[model samples]
Each structure stands twice: as C-alpha cells, then as structure tokens.
Target chain A: MITVALPKGSLLKDTIRMLQGAGLDFSGFLDSSNRQLQIVESSGRAQGLLVRAQDVPVYVEYGQAQLGIVGYDVLYEKEPNVAQLADLGFGSCRFSVATKKDGPYRSALDLPPHCRVASKFVHSARRYFQSIDLPVEIIPLSGSVELGPITGMSEAIVDLVSTGRTLKENNLMELEVLFESTARLVAHPLSYRLNVDNLSEYVDLIRQQVLVVA
Target chain B: MITVALPKGSLLKDTIRMLQGAGLDFSGFLDSSNRQLQIVESSGRAQGLLVRAQDVPVYVEYGQAQLGIVGYDVLYEKEPNVAQLADLGFGSCRFSVATKKDGPYRSALDLPPHCRVASKFVHSARRYFQSIDLPVEIIPLSGSVELGPITGMSEAIVDLVSTGRTLKENNLMELEVLFESTARLVAHPLSYRLNVDNLSEYVDLIRQQVLVVA
Candidate 1:
C-alpha cells in the first residue's frame, strides 16, 4: 500500500478535504474511533496514518509513509532531506519573534548576544539568530511559549502566532516575522523514484484542485 | 496569586486528588463548561493554569506558574533544569527500547553504528546511545513510535511503554529500559527563591503525601 501521513487536529479536516478533491475518498476514516489510527482509501491503493503535525515529515523522511501533510514551521525546524513536492494551501499561520510590549527588542538585531529566547523550533531559531550575527541561548520549550516572554524567563520568543489574540492578551507584540506558514504535501525521495508515474498522477490531481482554489 | 500549572488529560484527575489530600479544594474546576483557562482556588491565594502535560514545565520554568505537575517522561525529554522538589508517585511508566520480536537486536551493542532509531525523546535517545559508545541516527517522532520498527523505518524505538500490550500487538519486544518514570512536582528556581517559605511548605505537603503512598 502507498502510505500517507496526515496530521491530527485542525489540519486533519482540511487534509481530508484535499484528499477528497484529489479523488482519494477516505470517508471511512470519519468513524471517530481511536482504533482507526490507520485507514484504507476507497480504492485500497493508499493508506493514511494519523500522526502529530510535527512528526509528519519524520514519517515521510524515513519512508514509513510515502507522502505526508505537514506545517511549514515543522519543515523549517526539522529540515528533513525530503522532496517538498506540493503545497496543500491550508492551515496558514506565521512564525514570528515576539516580545513584551514594553521590552527593548524592537528588531531582530535589538536582541543582545547571549540573551535567552524560548521556542520549540530550536534549529530555526539558531539559524535565524546566527544570520543576524548574534549567538542566542535557546531554551527549548515544547509548548506555552507565550508564557516565556510574559513571565521574564526569556527576552523574546519565536512561535506560531495564528490570530495574534494570544500574544495581544498576554501583552506581547510581534517584533519580526520569521516566516509565513502553511501546510505542504511532502514526498519521500525513494517513493518518488520507485513509483514515479503513479505518484505524479496523484500529484497532478491535487495540484489541479489547488490551482482551481487559487 | 500562586499560580500552578496542572497537566491536562488523565493526569489532571490524579492531580486533583493529590491537591484535595493536601487540604486544597477547588471543586468548581470539575465543571466541563468552564472555558476559563485560569481558575481561582477557594482560598483566593492560589490559582490553576490548565495546560498540556508537555507544557507544564514550560510554564513553571518561566515562572508564569510557580509550580507544575507533570510526568517524568516529559521532564527527562525536555530537561527544563527546574527543581524537582517532589515525586507525586502516580502516572508510572518506563522508557523502553523496543524492536520487532523477531529482529536481530537483542542488546544495545547488537545494533550497527549509524543505524536509525525512532523516538519522541530525541535528547534521551542521543544520550543513551552516546553513553554506550554507539553513534546513531535518531529519528525524532512525536507519536506512534512503535510503527517505526513495524514499517522498517527504524530498527528500534525508544518510547514510554506503560504496558507491553501495544508492543506485543505491533510484533515488537522490549530490548532495554532507559528510565523508570512517574509523575513529579516541579518548581521554578527563582519562584522558590522569591517565596521560599510558602513554596517550601507547599513542597512539604506534597512530599508527605508521596511518602504515604510509597
């Protein structure tokens, strides 16, 4: 079976829609039972594996799943050597550097060397600060990164700001946008090599639907 | 107010029991409709911040929450460097290295250098392999780590296995245990310093309850 990894939660809804638009009807997956972690498509040619949004790329990169739908933020952080075949055009958000509304960091360079910043995306944060010639101490936080700047543990935070309400409510302001994020369809290099013709057809179907929406 | 970070899901039930045992009662918290993320205790001197289990340490480490209840698995994986003042003595589990029941690996040394192993605890996996003089490629996966060995993406997996049922169902067997895990009560270093007497008293209450259980 040609296995695909789908991220759970908010992205799952849009991902299912995208798959349906691509002529891959996997409605049986809507059973809402925890036992249905893996599902078979109507055609039985493809199978879907539900995983955390952050781990989608790892599944595809390791060839456990031939393809995966994942957020751009995770892609930037993991930097897995996989084929970024197509953009799924949903789950949009922004990767931003945020600080307390009253803090000194107005720009990226305003952050002093050795200052501590908290983020789940450690690699992306390191690369961003390195590009600005400042070595930062990154306190890797799994979640609740907004609490970092609010409580004085970090000088700034790099996190996904969806509606900006969370940041505003916490008295935080966006200093700079690191990247605009959206979900993308990624494929394994070996998968593409082994099933080039079939995978290309599947990609074409999804791309046609995306172009229609565009 | 003294803010405490309470882990969401099953752990929350055990935490509430522990707090009640400590003579702190907040019955209103049981109301499911209380969308209010923050809640005040009856005493009005303490408050609770509901957050993900993985995020409990993040809140406490930043001092947004002076204290937190989280699993030892998350604590070891994140390594937040906070003070673990008490082990609440519930939510017991262990981090185990598992492989297919019929795979070649019977011990850590049986795996080849540079062989890939999948795990949610990347830091733990790296440290364990490094200590054994084995260089490895750690495939960081957030969930369903057992699938790694099943799909041939990794030769073994390091994950929190409460019972061996999941591994057995996946045709896998435990090779070695990395750590024994349980729920822990963590506190921020600066928060403890700022309110030494109050925090120490709170810690003593939890420690006493844990001793009773142990």
Candidate 2:
C-alpha cells in the first residue's frame, strides 16, 4: 500500500476531495473532531498522514510517504528534494511585499538599505532581495508577520496574501508580488523512478485531477 | 495606558488569571468569543496585544509593547533585546534532545558528527551543540520535530517537551534536556529603564503575583 501526506490546514478539505475524485477514500480525516494524525483510507489502498504544510515535502523526500500535497511557496522556500508532480491549481495565493498602508514608501526599492523585512519565508525573502541587489535584513517571523510593520520592528514584510482580506484588515499595502502560489502534487523521486507501490499510477490520476481543475 | 503583549494560546488563560490576582483585569482575552487581537483591560489602565508566543518578544523588543509574557525558550532562541523581569512560572516545559526510542544512540554525544538534528529552536540547538564541541548538522523544522527521526530525515530532534506525553506517543525518548522553560515577564529595556507608562509599578505588582504563585 502507498502512503500520502496531506497538509492539515486550509487546503486539506479540497485536497481530500480531489483525492476522493481520484478514487482514494480519505473522508475519515474530513470529520472536524477527528484528531488522528495518521488515518487509513476506508478502502485500504493507502493511508494519509496529516502534517503541517511545510513538512509535506520532508515526508515525501525522506520516502516515509511516496506522495504529498503542499503549497508551492513551501516547495520554493524549503527546496526539499522531491519531484513536482502537478500544480493542482487550488488554494491560490501570492507571495507579496507589504508595508503599513500609511507608510511613505510604496515600492520594494524605496525601503532603505539594511532595513528590516520580516517574513516566515526567510529563504524566499532573502532571494528576492538578492535578486534585486537590495541589502535588507530579513527577520524571520513564524506568524503574524503583519505585525512587523505595525510594531515598527521592520519596515516591510514578505508574506502570503490570499483574497487580500488579511492585508486590508492589518492595515498593510502590497508593494510587489514575488510569485503566485498554488498547491501542487509532489512525490518522492525514487518512488516515481522505480514506480514503487504503483506510485506512477496514483500520480497520473492526481495529475489528471489537476488538469481538470485547471 | 501601558501596552502589553500576551501570548494567544495555552498560557493565555493562566496569564490572565495571574494578572487578575494582581488586580489588573485582562479577562477580555479569556473570553473564547473575543476575536480582538488587541483588547483593553477592564480598568483601562493597560491593553493586551494577543500574538504568537514567539512574536511576543518581537513586540516587546521593538517597544510596540512595553511588557510581554512569553516562554524563556523563545527569549533564548530569538535573543531579542528585552529585560527578563520575572519568571511567571506557569507554562513550564523543557528544551530536549530526543531520538526514536529504539535508536542505537543513547545521548547527544552518541549521535555521530555531521548527523542531522532537527529543531524549531535552531539557535538554541546550535549553541548547545557548540558548547559541547559537537559539529552536527541542524535542520530547522517549524513543528513536529518528532517526525524527523521517525521518517529518517534526521537522526535526532531538539524540541519543546511539555508533558513528555506527545514524545512518548511518537516513540521518541529524551536524551538530554538543554534547559527548563517557563513563562516570563519580559519588558522593553528602555521602557523599564525610563519607567514609561508607569511600567515599574505594574511590573512590581506582576512580580508579586509570581511570588504568590510560587
């Protein structure tokens, strides 16, 4: 039997639904009260390991789970060793540069050199600044990165923006978008190469689901 | 009015209860229905900024909040510029090194050099390994460090151990404890030094409550 790692937050429901569409039964995890981190699908074809979105690639890379569904932002940030199977095109969002809405600066280049830029995605933020030849300090914050500018701890923040509702609520204004992000199917490279446990078959079905969504 | 940063999860209720003992009411945060990130105390003498546990120090360090309640592990890991006022003593836990219970290695020293050790508290782990003159590779994981060992991603994990229940459930055993962590009253250094917003009096009262708890 094959194992698949499913992220546990926003994209979980849709991911499980897509898998069900591909003939996998993971409805047990959809129950609100189900606290089980690992659940066997009713059909015994595969088991699902509910994990943090960021850890999805880690599981697949280590071969504990032959497949995983995670955000593209995470895939880019961690750069874990895994094969990108398909972009499911769900849970769409963008990685953005933002500042306090009232701030005088309106662009990434306007922020002063060595100024702080807080983000949970430190790697991605660092690369973005490096690509622009800007020298800004990237302060790593796990969550509530919006508070960076609010608290004056940083001049700006690089965080995921979806629906733009949260940025509006936090009094932040988007300056530049780093990239568009969407959930993608990822698989262990070796598992795919060797077609272990018919990994290719499941991946093809999931790929078809992605194309359907797109 | 003084601004305070209170963590928003498990320690929140107990922190508010302790503040009530000090005659400062932050019960608004205790109300599960309260969605406000920033809420004023009943007396209007202080306001609380509900934030992630790790971000509490950031708020305090930048003077967005003159006072904050957070775990010592965060203080040591982030190494923010804040004055450690008093140990709130609630929310006690420990920073520990662990591996799969059945692993051959029995201690930190037993793990081979260059072996991967995963942790969210990367700074603390690095310092601990350095102090011991070990040069192991430390992989930063945001959460679920236990999965590091189980999935063969890392040989061991350094993480917060609250009840040891979760670690036990994961089939991991603690090899060594780096330090015991507890919630602490941390203050913005300049705020306390200048006694801004009558910070001294409030800290003294909160300190008294800690004494009572002990």
Question: Judged by lDDT, which candidate is best?
Answer: 2
lDDT of each residue in B1-214, candidate 2, tens digit only: 9888989887898888887887778888777787677877878898888889988987898788999999999999999999999989899998999998998988889999889999888999999999999899887766777778866779999999999998998899999999999999999999999999889999899989888888
- B-chain TM-scores per prediction: 0.93, 0.97
Residue B153 lDDT, candidate 1, scale 0-100: 84
Shift of residue A62 alpha carbon in model 2, Å: 2.7
In terms of DockQ, the best-performing candidate is: 1
Off by over 4 Å in 2: A42-45, A110-115, B42-44, B102-116, B130-135, B152-155
**Residue B50 lDDT, candidate 1, scale 0-100:** 75
Off by over 4 Å in 1: A100-116, A130-137, A168-173, A193-197, B1-3, B25-30, B36-40, B58-66, B102-114, B130-136, B189-195
Q: Which residue pairs collide, candidate 1? A: none
lDDT of 1 by residue, B4-113 (tens): 88888768888887876775655456678765456788887788887789889878886778889999988887889688888788988879888889888898889889
Q: State the local distance difference test value for candidate 2.
A: 0.89
| Per-residue lDDT of candidate 2, residues A6-57 (tens digit) | 9989999999989998889787888889867788888898988888898888
